[model samples]
Every structure is written in structure tokens, then in C-alpha cells.
Target: MDTAGLEILGEEECLRLLADVPVGRIVYIDRALPAIQPVNFVVHGQSVVIRTAARSRLAIAATGTVVAFEVDEFNDNCVRHGWSVVAVGRAGQVTDDQELASVRQRGLRPWAPGTREYYLRVDIEIISGRRLRHADAPAGP
Candidate 1:
């Protein structure tokens, strides 16, 4: 798509958008190749927290491994506008009992059926986003 009608979102706006959504995709490297997985997450300060099975791929992600987490919303109507937010960061397992308890209080539950007992946290270092709208559409409030 063209960038003519795209608006670059600020960090605060990106975080707001991230917190507004419950599901996002995490892009990581697996076996020398890029792999992306859909995960339900919650925003914890500047980090994104996700719960997965102990043996799941996300739970096995190495500490300090760079990854990208993205969330987006699109309109399928005639207007056809959408916005996407992406956060790049390092992924690590949450091992601290105190922190884990705090995250649990936030109710970051997984929608998938499984024994999701492992918690992974992505420390956001970089965040960027864009909104695409029709050329003639009115500016968003």
C-alpha cells in the first residue's frame, strides 16, 4: 500500500494501542529461520507478558533474544482503514515469583487450550506504528 495516507504513531500512542488489544503476534528466530506465533498478551509497564505451555516454542525462546510483537486492527467496511503497532524487544522467561504474581494479578490469560503455565516477558526497546486511511477520510479524533 501507499504511504501517502499513513500516519506515524508516537510511542505513547503505540503503547495505548498495544494495551487495547489482547492478542498479538511474536516474531522470533527458530532453527535459523523466522517464526511467528499468535499469542494473547498483556502490557506490563514497558514489557509485554504472554502465557504459554511449558514446552511451547515461545516458552523456549532464549533470554535476550530479539523479537517483534505486533498488534493491529482493520476496518473491513467501505472506509477500509487500519492501524498496526509493532514492538521490538528482547524475550525472556519470567522466573521471579514476585513479578510472576504481579503479572498474574493482571489476568493475562491465554485463549488456547493447553497447560499454559509458563510466562514470557518481552522487554520493549523499540516501538513503531502506522495508521492507514482513505485519502478522503476525515481525520481521526
Candidate 2:
């Protein structure tokens, strides 16, 4: 047998869950259309940092705008609990080469091959999250 659904977890649990995962989804508005993409990120202080190719959508999305990031996980037994944290804030490219290089040094590699000529640093503003523990999640956090 198998079961699947979303459960809302507590705030502490949400942060803990966030630290356990390295990948998340970043949602942004593009020309009035909503776009979402999975990305590898590091939670730096209150912000999320991700590396991207020079001309990729991720890079384009980071041009002085706010974006959303979500990460969640489930158990193998199909009985699982997970949470999603959304960071709504302004996005920008990390201009300092030294800082960018340091992120590379931290072992955050890109899934896409070839030269990753750009990196994005998203400063979180509204940090709200929700956890999925059962079938019905209230109104979210």
C-alpha cells in the first residue's frame, strides 16, 4: 500500500528540514507568467545562494527582483513528514569575485555542465514555512 499528501510542520521543524536538504524550487514571475525551477542552494544567514550559467533563466530571474524557494522531503516507507520554506525577497548577483569563489570552495556545484559564469544571492524578507505531516494542512504558515 502507498499514501501521499502534504502535512504542515512547526517552525523549528521547518528550519531543521531545510538544513537537511540542499535542493529547492525557486519560483518567480516572468513577464506576468509564473515560472518555477529546481535548484541547489545554500542557506546563507537569512538568504539563499545559488549558482547559475551566465544566460540561464535563474540568472535572468535574479536581476533585481524577489523570488521564492521551497524544499521538502519524504520517507521511504511512504509514511513521511516534510516541510517547505519560502523566502520572498530581492535577488541579485553576487558581485564580489572572492565571495563567489568562496561558494565554489564550499562544494556547491552546478548540475549543468560547462562554465557557470554567474551566481545569484537572494535576500529573504518574508520567511514563512509549512510542514506536511498528515492529509489536511491548515492555511499554511
Candidate 3:
């Protein structure tokens, strides 16, 4: 519903916005339960690259399974200006030597301390987003 100036964002716009932000939430199963963790990510050619600690719960469980990654930008002060994007896909580790090397060059690192050497890539299977803005504000550049 486009209520109160809310609009569904197109795939292109959603992907664009996803790349603009450096952090997002990764939603996946941890011990048969739903878990979401804020993570630093980089959008690399239709995939979200994430770095986590090796053998960590998320790095182990989320791999080879369906997961959802979400990113959003909002200005609380501006009551009606914000956007959020979610990408649901299969998460996998970047084990390929060449691929891993390329991703390492992209600089996707964890914000928290410690050695988070595990690298995961979540393919963008189903992507969607919504944007809320003042009615008077125009859409698109």
C-alpha cells in the first residue's frame, strides 16, 4: 500500500541503496531459532559479502541455507523520510581461492574487534524494499 507517501522501491533502486550503506542485518537460523545480527557488508555484483569469525555460530549455521539480509536508512527527525531493503537468498562461504581473493580486495570487514576471518556471500534471490517520503518530495533523480 502506498499509504502516507510510502512507495515500494524497484529492484534497481533497492540494490543501489543496499550498496550505499556499509551495514545491514543478517537474518538466519541459529540452533533452529531465528536470529538477526547487525553486520558490516558490501554489495558485490548481486551478492552481499559479509565477514564473520571462523567457526562462529552464524558463519556455520547460515551457510548453505536461506537467509535474509536487510539494510535501511532513515532520519528519525524527518518523520516521513526513510527507506529499507531486504534480500533473501542462499548464503554460502567464499571458498574459491580466486573469488575469495577478489572479495578480500573489496574490503568487507567486521566492525567489531577480534579476527573475523570467515567470509560469506548471500546471493540476491528475492529482493524488495520500500521508501517513505513527504508527498511533496519528488521521486527519482
Candidate 4:
């Protein structure tokens, strides 16, 4: 397939790109509807960790369920070129004392100013990414 000239990224490259970005969107169900919300995250082990308030929609929907997380970077100054990585996995609340301590050590504080004490972890079971090249970037074989 032509793939519309997008470059398909490998798993390692996808994870690297994910780790390079600080913010991503979490896709989950809210009130029985699909929703997306921006969040600050960190790559720990083979999972993505997110911090949020106890009662937030994400906190409520993320626990013990499957969700999708995505990150992207683009340059629009002169050309519209970017790369996006999407990760899908089962998410669960981080309740173990040791794991909690470790994630806290990562210094992943909430971007939004408020009391956010809950930590959610999503295991990166399936990950894929694609790159949109500038007009000049070669479509390498």
C-alpha cells in the first residue's frame, strides 16, 4: 500500500518518541462515551504512568480497563510535518506501596494545579507510530 507517504515507525522508535514527549492524550470512556483528555505522563518500564485527582473522569475510567494513549510532535513553521505514537493497553490503579514509591520518585507532578494523588498505569501491550514527513523528506525504501 502507498500508505499516503507516511513512514511507519517500529516499536522501539515509537517508545522512544513517546518518552521524548511530556504530554499526551488519554483516550477513555467517559459517561459511556469515548473521550480524550490531555495529561502529563512518563514512560516507566513498559508502561505509561499518569497522575490525576481521585474523582476525575480519567481516574474513574482508567482503572482496570483498556485505554489508548497518544503523543505527537509537529513542525508547522514552514511545513506540516509530524510524528504520532499511539499505545493501547490495560490500565490499572497503582496501589502497591513499592510501585507507588517508584512512580513518585519519577517526579511526575500534575500539570494542572490541584491535589492529584492517584497514579494510574497503562501497560504498553500494543504500540504503533507513524511519521508525516515534510515535502522534501524522501520516501525511503
Candidate 5:
């Protein structure tokens, strides 16, 4: 992709954008191969929390495993006009009763129909993003 119209976003801006989105893709290694799953999530402090089944691949991911969580928004009529944010971190299950209760209060629900009884939290170590603005778009204030 061309880099002329791309603007690198700072960590704070990236986190703010992430907070506005409800869905993101979680990338992890599964059986020696990289896999991606779309999940509904919420940003809790510096971590991204997602709900999944206990036996699901995501829930079973070993603690401290490095993973990538990405969220983006694009214009249908103009695909190039959009922004993407990625959070790289280690995956950890929310096993603490107090933490689980706090996360539950955020009402993080899955869009899929099924029993999602496990919560996985990704402790973000690095966050980066880029925005693609049209050539004719007005500059920021």
C-alpha cells in the first residue's frame, strides 16, 4: 500500500479509537499455525477483554502467549479511507474473582450465539495505528 496519505497514530489515539469499536480480530498461534478469530471485546484499562468458551482455542491459549488484537474501520465507497489499530500483548485468562466481577460490569457480550463462559484478557504491551485519509480530505484542526 502507498504511504503518502498514511498518518501514524500515537498510542493514546489508538486506544481511544479502539474504545469506540466493538469488534476486533484476535491473532494467535494455533497448532503451529497462525489463526485469526473475530471477537467482540471491550477495552479495560490497558487490556482488551473478550469472552469465549472454556474449551475454545482462544480460551485455551497458554498464559503469557504473545498475541495480536486488531480493529479497523473503513468506508465502503472508498476502501482507502480508514484507520486501523493493532495491540500486541500477552494473553491471560481472567481468573481473579474481583477482576472478573469488574469486567462483567462492563457488559462485554459476544455477538455469536452460544455459551461463552470464559474471559481472556490481553495485556497490551504495544499499540500502533495508521489512518488513511483521502487526498482531498480536509486537514485536522
Candidate 6:
């Protein structure tokens, strides 16, 4: 079997990509308006963790919300294809002291400056991934 010029990553590879990336775009709705924001996140166990301010939009939008967490990587030369991992899940505040302690021990830090007082855990309901290549055509002309 010869695999060449083909880009197909296994589930483990996708998980590796997810674990390696620190920042992703989170998709949610605010008052029926679509929104996407770059967020700092960590993949813990089978879920995704995010730290935000107590009153920030992400913290508010994530409370009891079903959202999308997406991460991807690409190169300018395009010789190496990029992969995307999308996690669809419900977001909620992380209140368990033990869990919070464990998360803190993992060295997960907030991207924004100052004290990030809110922590959210997104229980992953569905996880899927796709690959992108320079050869792929744009959706529209």
C-alpha cells in the first residue's frame, strides 16, 4: 500500500492536533446574533475548558449554552495540509473545587490580562474533524 499526495489523519492524529493547539474560535449566539471569537482553551479528558472574565461576553454566552469549538492550522506554502477539529457541546460554569484545582494544576492560563474569574467546561457531545488542502477550491467565485 502506497499513500502519497493524500492527506488523511487518523482519530489519534486529530486528537493530537486538538491537544497541541491552544487557541480556537468559539461560535455562539448572542440575542439571535451569530458570533465568533478567538478563545484560549485546553482539552481535558473528553471535554474542553475555557477561562473568561466573570462578565465577559464569552462567559455570558457560554452559560448553559450549546456552542462550537473549532481549531485549525495551515501553512502559506500549502505543502502540508491542515486539519480542523470541531467539538459541539454544552457550556457551563466549572464550580467543582476539586476539578478547578486540577485544572489550575494543569497550567492552563487565560489569554487576557488580569484575573479571569470565570471558568467553563464544555461537555463534548460530538467531536468531528476535517482536513484542508491548498488544492481545494473556494466555495464561491
Instruction: Identify the candidate with maximal lDDT.
Output: 4
User: Model 6 over residues 60-92: C-alpha lDDT tens digits?
Assistant: 866899998899876545635566788899988
lDDT of each: 0.85, 0.72, 0.88, 0.89, 0.87, 0.78
Evaluated at residue 22, the lDDT of candidate 2 is 78
lDDT tens digits, residue span 41-136, model 5: 999999999999888887776356999999998876777578999999999999999999999999987777799978999999999999988786
Candidate 1 minimal-lDDT segment of 10 residues: 132-141
Clashing pairs in 4: none
Sorted on lDDT, highest at the top, how do the candidates line up? 4, 3, 5, 1, 6, 2
Pitting candidate 2 against candidate 6, the one with the higher lDDT is 6
Residue 122 local lDDT, model 5: 94
Please tell me which predicted candidate would have the highest TM-score against the true structure: 4
Write down the TM-score for model 5: 0.90
Cα RMSDs, all models: 2.4, 6.0, 2.4, 2.6, 2.5, 6.0
Candidate 4: where are CA atoms >4 Å away?
137-141
- State the displacement of the C-alpha of residue 10, model 1, in Å, after optimal TM-score superposition: 0.8
Candidate 6: RMSD to truth: 6.0
Better of 3 and 4 by TM-score: 4
**Model 6 regions lying over 4 Å from their true place:** 1-10, 134-141
User: For candidate 1, lDDT tens digit of each residue in 1-141?
Assistant: 336657898889999999998789999988788889998898998999988887876667635699999999876563457899999999998999999999999998778887888888999999999888776665563
Could you give candidate 2's per-residue lDDT for residues 6-102 as a string of tens digits? 4445556656666668789888888778998898878776678888887887688556888877786654444344456766888888888788777
Lowest lDDT block of 10, candidate 3: 132-141
Off by over 4 Å in 2: 1-13, 76-80, 135-141
Q: After superposition, how far is residue 114 of candidate 4 from its true place, in Å?
A: 2.5
TM-score of each: 0.89, 0.77, 0.88, 0.90, 0.90, 0.82
Kindly list the per-residue Cα lDDT of model 3 for residues 1-141, writing each as its tens digit.
466456888999999999988789999998889999999888888899999988888898999999999999877566567789999999999999998999999877678899988899999999999987777544533
